[model samples]
Target: MFIDASTNSLTVSHRPTNAPSGLIESLKQYPTANVGDAMDRLNLMDTGIASQWANGRCVGPALTVLTREGDNLAIHRALDDAEPGDVLVINALGGTTRAVFGDLLAEICLAKGIAGVIIDGLTRDRAAIKELGLPVWARGVSPAGPAKYGPGAVSVPVACGGTVVNPGDLITADDDGVAVIPVERAQSVLSRLADIDKFEEDLRVRIRNSAVHAAAPAMASTN
Candidate 1:
């Protein structure tokens, strides 16, 4: 497909549909930090994408978009073409001066049932976005708007948040941050996260019990 550079026309291919089912639900049981710990056990580095949500979490397969700095034509195309439960993982080359998305586009994503947006650039309309309750993770927020003109591609592998995101890769984000699990590694990562969750829970209980035991001696001495 040919894109018109003059118009910033976008050519989008179908997003991959083979994401593992139930993994997203399973991931939701743990925080992004726990998930990151699990990925670390496998030597996967942090995604480095900051979570911008006023509330709630985001979990889904990625629909990758690669665009020129300060341009978001491909992002608009990705929104139109992405399936439900797909996170629009955008690589804007780490441009921080211009916001690639705003409240208006976020409304479109909500209406279309997009899981969330993770931009490696900037976003605007922070107040409205928080009110609207859309999960948005980005490098920063800028009031400067992006140009529609683009040299970009949709549904292609892109470097986002200091990580390489391929279409259909599992994207999980929350108050902590975002993490990308490769499509081929989702199952193993999920299993590891489960183990981590259990370990953390046990540690929490042990710490509480020890604290109680330590305080019991002081209480008895006072009596």
Candidate 2:
């Protein structure tokens, strides 16, 4: 469970056998819902730091990144150490002053099999990112540059888009919003989400039939 401080790498001993199935399926149900609802159910913050460039939904495992102000050495390091099917979670101190990612970063991530990037910071090269068809969730866009300073970490716990993302956790993002499911509780939450989805579907059916009541019945009716 220990990660190398210098290398910022750790062999994940406990891989979720489910392959992030539950929420992934839930996304199918509410194709237009934001990923933030699921995150709120899991007690996550809505960092308001994301935007979609790709057309479809986004779902994958997390690769957390923490960096000092205007510095992305750790982010660069994380990418080098990134594995396939990873979602890069960047904790950029909520700084919208400079872009932490751009066309080059998006290109690198796509080539490495990274699912997406969710950053609590700014990003540039908007046209290029959109052109590349990469999924990026960030606070905003800026043309400012980042510093190559010290004090940063990767593959560790980080807060992005108002969620606490631990390395190897599951992240599912879409036009709805971004949601983070803990690797430990993913299955259970997914089950609950399924039930919610079913109930909502039934409700929709009733509404379509004009069978839904406008208000509660009178107290006398309870008798």
Best by TM-score: 1
> Model 2 Cα RMSD, Å?
7.4
lDDT per residue for candidate 1 within 70-139, as digits (tens), equals 9988887777676778888899998988999899889888888888888888999988988998899988
lDDT for predicted candidate 2 compared with the true structure? 0.69
TM-score of candidate 1 on Cα atoms, chains taken together: 0.90
Error of 2 at 72 (Å): 1.6
Kindly give the stretch of ten consecutive residues in candidate 2 with the minimal lDDT sum.
7-16
Q: lDDT for each of the candidates? A: 0.80, 0.69
Cα displacement (angstroms), candidate 1, residue 32, comes to 1.0
Across 64-110, the per-residue lDDT of candidate 2 in tens digits comes to 88887566666777777677778888889998788878887788888
Worst 10 residues of 1 by lDDT: 1-10
Model 2 regions lying over 4 Å from their true place: 1-40, 52-56, 211-223
Identify the candidate with maximal lDDT. Answer: 1
Runs of candidate 1 with Cα error greater than 4 angstroms are: 1-11, 41-48
